[model samples]
Target chain A: MEAAVEMKGISHWFGKVQVIHDVDLSVEKGEIFGLLGPSGSGKTTLVKMMTGLLRPSKGVVQLNGEKMPSLKQLRQFGFMAQSDALYSELTGRENLDFFASLYGMSRKDRHLRMNHVLDMVDLTAYASRPVNTYSGGMKRRLSLAASLIHEPELIILDEPTVGIDPVLRQSIWSELNRLRNHGVTIIVTTHVMDEAEKCGHLALLRDGRMMAEDIPSQLKSKLGVSSIEEVFLHYGGGARA
Target chain B: MNTAAVVKRILKQFHRDKRSVALMVAAPLLVLTLMWLVLDTETSAVKLAAVDVPAQVVESIETEGITVTVMDEAEAEEKLNEAEIGGVLQWEDGAPFVILEGSDPNTSGTIRSTLQKQLSEQNASMEWEYWNGSSELGLFDYVGPALIGFFVFFFVFIVGGVSFLRERTQGTLERLLASPVRRSEIVFGYLGGFGLFTVVQSIIIAAYSIYVLDVFMAGNFLYVLLVTILMALTALSLGTLVSTFAGNEFQMIQFIPLVIVPQVFFSGLFPTEGLAEWVQVVGNLMPLTYGAEALRDIMLRGSSFESFQVEVYILLGFTTLFTVLNIAALKKHRPL
Candidate 1:
């Protein structure tokens, strides 16, 4: 069976500065994969490449065994960028409706999926309110809702839970687990250590290079450390952290 | 297919932002009204002092609008110096020589032309004929077509460009690109949404100018709408293209002097006859020049579409070119 996501010898450069060094990655279906890194560790750039939002300077990116940057393949995944990309002038429901339609959802399907995603993000009550009136945490949840409205097999989220509170974060993680149990593949990028622990598999990246890739507990055990942060420190990733 | 979604969202946003809609629709009427008030004044009556001139000549000079006061040389000179009279008309040598108080161009030009018409008509040797517009056409009437084109271009450029810029700065554009939506779809979606709004805007502005303010409309109103709509689309596409380069709203404003104001000078507000060759070449490259020319041909001369088809095609070509540039500029965000 084809892996849910696959990349080989991926490298990217923004002008003279190389942001993503050579990297290889593969994630199996029905697994929650995490990319852990500091702010400038190229986590966003790497995830953007996987969605064909950016073309790598050199490499191949495939999702479900299909070469990316194809519109047909693009319909199979959803992306949420580091910034909350909701249209503040629109109601929360309208924002979701717009993205759902872009995925070629029917009107009836849009109504169903919009309500479902809004419920998943705990935004059903505030769905009719303009996003500009939403609080920062609310906006973050709404963005997450928009990304999931299409119900793609794979979802790529960049720092999805940045300003969200602990309770909502727990709920969101539970939702991710629920989706994973139903055979959905997930890729998430974050700098939060505890959040990284929730992923079934983690890749610790620093300075555009992957330092280690393993299950969270196994990574700590192999380094004889008690926490993922120590395992990160063990691999020279704590200079700024 | 997703273009409808984008269009629907834009219309909803416009509905929410009533102030911008008002700016686009009503502000032009206000400015055009003010321009009519200022430029459409009745020709102020010119008062002339006739000195040592024959009774028949003075009587001829005192025709319709011009009123000639019979006086001696000293009285006429004193009145002229006091600025109470516009000019001193006296016989010098064998010819009728007039001394004009040249402070105001309008009054002095009127005095000169009045005297010339009267003196030349003493022989009844000259006949006047108008080939196009009557002599009653005011400054407002002459420049009204261009101003309509200008306002449509200016407001649409600012509103459309800034709106597109907000999508970039607010990060929504990147999110939109992440979908299966094609780049051309996004461009077409914006064009359709804003294009519909501008159509209504242009009609309101054109109707108010022609019917209420009474600026001049000799040709078909439908053609005027057609030209104005094309002008608005040209501005819309150019605005989106410019937004691709603008970093923020402030940068978009900065383009007014660079991109818009020069078009005003070339847009038929001022005569380009004496301008340099290269300068006229630059004006030909601007979309407003063609729009203004097409508008004037239709509004002033009542020319048929065949006469201004070149301008029509050029405006369409400009829109197509800018729209293509807009779609290509999206590549900066998403390679596809």
Candidate 2:
């Protein structure tokens, strides 16, 4: 079986500056895979390549054994960018309904899935309110809900829980766990260490290079550290054992 | 397919953002109304010095509403130098000799035309025979169609550009790409959605100008409507396509002078007879040029549908070109 997503010798450049260096990655199905890096570390660029939102300067990005940036394969994934992408002029339900139709969901399924996702994000009460009236945390939750509206098999989330409250963040992660249980493969990029620990497998990236990739506990054991932060700090510092 | 969803979302957004919708409709209407009012009020009386002219001539000119003053030649010259009177009209050996002050073109034009009408009417020597449009056609009648084309293009371009730019800044465009929707669908969706809105806007603006402002109309009303709608669609596509290059809302607005304002200069607003050959060629590249020309042909000249087919094809060609480019530009965000 094909890995959920694969990147081989991937390199990207914007003008003279290189944003993502040669990197190889393979993400399996039913896994909560985390890409951890600081700002400007190229995590966003790397993840964008996987979605076919960007083409690598050199190399291939494949999802489910298909060459990526393919329109047919694009239907299989959901995306939440680093910014809250909701249309402030639109109501939460209307925004969700719009995306639902883009995904070719039937009207009945849209009505059903909209309710489910709104409930998942706990935004049912504010469904009718314009998104501009939504608080920062509420907007984040709404964006999360929109991504899951199509029930995509592979979901790519970039900094999904930044401004979310702790309680909401916990619920969102728990929901991610539930999706994973149902065989949904998730690729998430974040600088938050706590969010990193929730991932089943982690790739520690620094300066566009994949510093390390392993299960969280295995990385911790190898580094002889209690926390993923220490492992990141050490590897990010280029102190390889 | 998914274009309908985009259209639906845009309509809903328009409903939510009532202020923008109002700005799109009302701003143009207000400006057009002001222009018509100004055109109507162009009958402002011109001050002229009547010298060596018989009292009968002065009385006939006065009856036509020109303010005439009794003065000698040197006194009239002094008043003309002082910018007091627009012109001096005198009779010399049965022929009329008129010395115009001629500083202000608008006032000068009024004085000359008023003098001509008075002379023609009082002596009954000239027959005013209009070939196409009547002698009743006002300046507003000539410019009104171009103004309609311009404002429709201006408003729709800004709104369309800004709305599409917001999609990128707000990140919604990235989300759309990740879905099953194709890049072309996004462009078509925007075109369809905003296209419908502009159609209503064109009708309201054109009707208000023709009926309420009483601008001269020689051709079919539906043809004017057709030209305005086509012009708006061209603007819609160009604006959305240009927005892909903009990094923010302000950048999109910056394109107004560079992209839109130039179209007005070449849109038959001013007479291009004295313009450079290259300058006219540049105007030909602007979609508004075709639209404005088509409007002028239909509204002023009462030309046949064949006269407008060139402009119609050019506008549609521009629409198709911009839409194709926009779909390609979106690949910068999502390659598929």
Most DockQ-accurate candidate:
2
DockQ of each: 0.70, 0.71
Give fnat of each prediction, in order. Answer: 0.80, 0.93
Candidate 1, residue A74: the lDDT equals 86
Worst 10 residues of 2 chain B by lDDT: B123-132
Query: Which pairs, if any, clash in model 2?
Result: none
**Compared with the true structure, what per-residue lDDT tens digits does model 1 show for residues B127-152?**
33222455566678878999999999
What ranges in model 1 sit over 4 Å off? A237-241, B40-125
| Predicted candidate 2 versus true structure: per-residue lDDT over B232-258, tens digit per residue | 999999999999889899999899999
Instruction: Determine which window of 10 residues in candidate 2 chain A has minimal summed lDDT.
Output: A232-241
If chain B of candidate 2 is superposed on the true chain B, what is its TM-score? 0.76
Question: Residue A99 CA error for candidate 1 (Å)?
Answer: 1.0
